[model samples]
Target chain A: MSGTSMTTRAWLLLLPLLAVMVAVIGWPLADTVGLSFTDAKLVGTAGNFVGIDNYVKTISGSNFQRSLITTAEFAIISVFAEMVLGVLAALLLNQQFYGRTVLRGLMILPWALPTVVNATLWRLIYNPEYGALNAALTQIGLLDAYRSWLGEPGTALASLIVADCWKNFPLVALIALAALQAVPRDITAASLVDGAGPFSRFRFVILPYLAGPLMVALVLRTIEAFKVFDIIWVMTRGGPANSTRTLSILVYQEAFSFQRAGSGASLALIVTLLVAVLAAAYAALVRKTAGSNA
Target chain B: MSALEIENIRKTYGAIETLKGIDISLDSGEFLVLLGSSGCGKSTLLNIIAGLAEASGGDVRIGGRSVLGVHPKDRDIAMVFQSYALYPNLSVRRNIGFGLEMRGVPTAEREKAVLETAKLLQIENLLDRKPGQLSGGQRQRVAIGRALVRKPQVFLFDEPLSNLDAKLRMEMRTELKRLHQMLGTTIVYVTHDQIEAMTLATRIAVMRNGRIEQLGTPEEVYDHPATLYVAGFVGSPPMNVLDGVATGEGLRLDGSDRLIALPVHFKNAVPSGKRVKIGIRPEALRLVEDDDRQPALKVAVEVVELTGPELVVTGRVGGQRVTACLPPRTKLAVGTTQAFAFDDDALHLFDAETELAFGR
Candidate 1:
């Protein structure tokens, strides 16, 4: 075939997907970028372009700086904790035992629950007066009085971290479990004949096999955590003097509650940029790992 | 004590019994092959010996010790899988040395062993590359190197060469025999190919439905098969069998008047009018003269196939298609009728109901 005809054939095959991308993501993203530089509210027909003002204001605000820190802290801590717990769970579940199928089915239930519902359930459990956590702590003689978990400044972020881990660690567990399943049974057998104990077998055989999926899960969970808004928004609403505030929560507050369209639009753009950077970093890491292995 | 001994081992999965009862003994430096078709429990028996799968009801002893409760790691055995299960993330050096590292071998010793094994397998140039960067033969060599570094008492192979192409398979077959000769270790290998079984094994165990049908040397099984199944399965083009009835002087074809004289032993044991299956190899058939010296049959040549070394000619004798092997340069063509005969001593007779060969 001629090069021109080959190029046309490739475009012909890609036409449908290209049309869908333009309609769904390309046009909306372009509209958002245009609106960010203008003074248009959600209801406005038109507005004058005011260049670089929103960018300057977005970078200079204390609220934006604090939320950026909060988002970073949330992303780092939650993803780390989830990775640890997920790997442990996957290891335990990978072993053959009685009732293994039932246990696997139960593990998937937490991941299958709605995120909003999980947040609501955790909120009730963290209530100060008669919640399950407070009741158990007092009953166990660890506390003399009931303490509000999501209300205290020192406890609010910690409480939200616990809730976020509960809601999302199963995703990591599922991914890790898939990776564990891919490890060849013969390699593990060979390790055993080499006089490796269970711990050594995991270190040498299982962990090396799981490296690819672990990196993938780490990247995906970090990106999801950086933009997390639903569970934290419902549970604490960035309360207790904004200690639990994140970039996504700030965007919601500025655009919807406080109605600062320019600041909100500018904050949203910054959030997009931050996510893009992390995604790029993860993409580079994955590509490097793949290329080296190949 | 022998290196390994299995006594009346049986395996059952749910209600379906796969392996009936199998008994095998392996001496030190012996290469034993369990040869059978798919679903014949050859792999299952190998897994049992490796301690990967437990025998439902039997004892497996290795080096005079029972390995029933021993873990696969503690069994002092290494296996190369058919898939060449290499660790994708690790370099060839790491993969080959991983077992030594697990056993607490020092880094210096591990490196020396890895280098020696890689040299033995001729894979020294591939140490820094991952398995994905190597060819199928190289990957297979790495798998062998991984097993060699363990220096275990016994080596188990589960059809390791079935995944390779024909030429590579032949090369690997030669290398495996050479390795066995040099190492002088006990090996329990499983394969469905009779040619491999014949060439590589000191003794061959033919399995059927999880039971050992016959166990002997290659020549013994090929020349003196214990049952009709063994005779049919051990040769290419298979032994030709036809149903007939024992008469006064010989056995007569069921639907025809042709009678074939049998040797003394078959004539005495086989009762008259009893149904019997007659088997004769294609190569055992020969062209005979129109004389009264011995009994003869007339057959019409239907097709002549000129293979490289031999000619396989199909013909019709007494309304049944029979094939005969002739010299490749013989003058023969389709639709040319000829008379063929076989020595009475070369005939094989089996009891039809039991499919067991009637002994001479």
Candidate 2:
């Protein structure tokens, strides 16, 4: 067959997918863009176009600004913590030890649980009355008495981050473990014979193999942490003066709770743009690391 | 003092013993090749000596000091691996200098040593490139450079040239020999290639099933193999064995009514009607005319292979297959009968049951 016909046939095969994408994604996206420019209600007649008023108000509002800062803090702190904890876990599990296979299998349990279920479990653990975490801390002489965890603004966001990390760090560990397996035994042996201590061996010989894969995990976890919603919503409902509120949670409150659809659409688009920028930066970093590794 | 010594080293994995009891001592500046086929425990012995793997029993010493529980880095050894194992992330210079860097050598001194090592290996131009950017031969040079820079008390190579193409392997083999001459470093090399063992080793230890079959100089190994396995393994076309039974007057060939005279020294060494195996190297057998005075065997020729320098002819002798290397231009054809004679001094006799060489 000629090249032109092949191209035509490829397009024909892709037509159904493209159509579905236009209906589900493209149409909704277009509608949201239109809605952002008008004063619209969740269930009422179409509002008159106000031309950039929603965008202006959303960008200037305290809610958008505070949520953006909160989202950034959560994403940066949680992703950094997850990467370190994950790599440490992976390194430990990679060693020769008893019950290693069982431990590796059990490591996936938290990640395997549904986000809502994981959030609910953490809530019980953080309960101010008789939560396991409070009981354990008091028993260990670290706490004077049981204190409000999820109910208080000071500890609410930190508690959510800990819970989020528990549910997500295993994914990073799994990726790192696979990369560790690909490191040739001979190279490590050579390094050992070259008079390298354990730390040097890991830094000079093993880290290069892990960098590319870990970068992938970093990008994924960072983006997920930035747009986090379900876990916080289920655990705290962005509670205690909105201290644990993230961009997604703010968007939900603006659109559904307050029924301000126009400004909600504007705020969501701004968050999407920020995430796109972060993803692009991480993609560039991945490319550079992959190139150097190759 | 010996440069390296392995004293009755043993390794066991669960119930299977990988190294039964290996003992080898190397003097300074001697190249000892552990020559064996795969699964022969040659690599296990090397690892034990390098302190990469622990020996279940016995102790290893370097420079007369026991290194049994010492870490590999503190053992004062350097190794070249089969895969080259050059750090793929670092430039060639850093790969060669990494050991010194780990030891906290000054930056300028490490760079100078790296440059000198790279120049000796003729990889000066590749110092700026990663291992991924080099050809197989170049990668091999970098691996050697990594080992050479340290100038350790002992050097171990685990089939370092096996990854190269045939031509490159030959080149690297020559290069290795040249390096050994220049540095005069104590070395232990491992390979299954007999040609490599013969050409490079001052002493070759032939191994089988986690035990040393024979250990001797290359000439001693080639000319006077101590065991049946060594005789079969150390030759290219390989040594051929014919079954015979000793008689009072001579030896009777199996499946044939021919009596061949044994060497005078072996005549009374065996009892009458005792079975023995006679090993003859292919090059030791020569085609002879019928009227030749030398005692000869009638061989039923099966195949003729003309390898550039010689004609290797495979044939049957008294129900046993034998290979003989003849003159390149000799006239020979398949399915023909020929008379072949071997020098009496070239004969090797082994008891059929024990497969151990008989006393001359």
Best by lDDT: 2
Of the candidates shown, which would achieve the greatest TM-score relative to the real structure?
2
Model 1: lDDT of residue B313: 85
* lDDT digits (tens) for residues B1-360 of candidate 1: 789899999999999889898899889999999999999999999999988888899999989889998988788888888888787778999989987787779999999999999999999999999988999999999999998988888889999999999999999999999999998978889999888898899999999988898999888777767778887888776776777888887878766686777677676788888898887778878777656466555668898888889989888777776788878888876887787787875678888999887777
- Per prediction, fnat is 0.67, 0.82
Candidate 2 local lDDT, A13-80, one digit each (tens) = 99999999999999999999999898898779688899999989988989888988999899998899
User: Which pairs clash in model 2?
Assistant: none
Off by over 4 Å in 2: A281-294
Docking class of 2: high
Which runs of model 1 end up more than 4 angstroms from their true locations?
A1-31, A38-50, A281-294, B290-298, B343-345
lDDT of each: 0.86, 0.92
Model 1 steric clash pairs: A192-B73
Cα-based lDDT at residue B125, candidate 1:
95
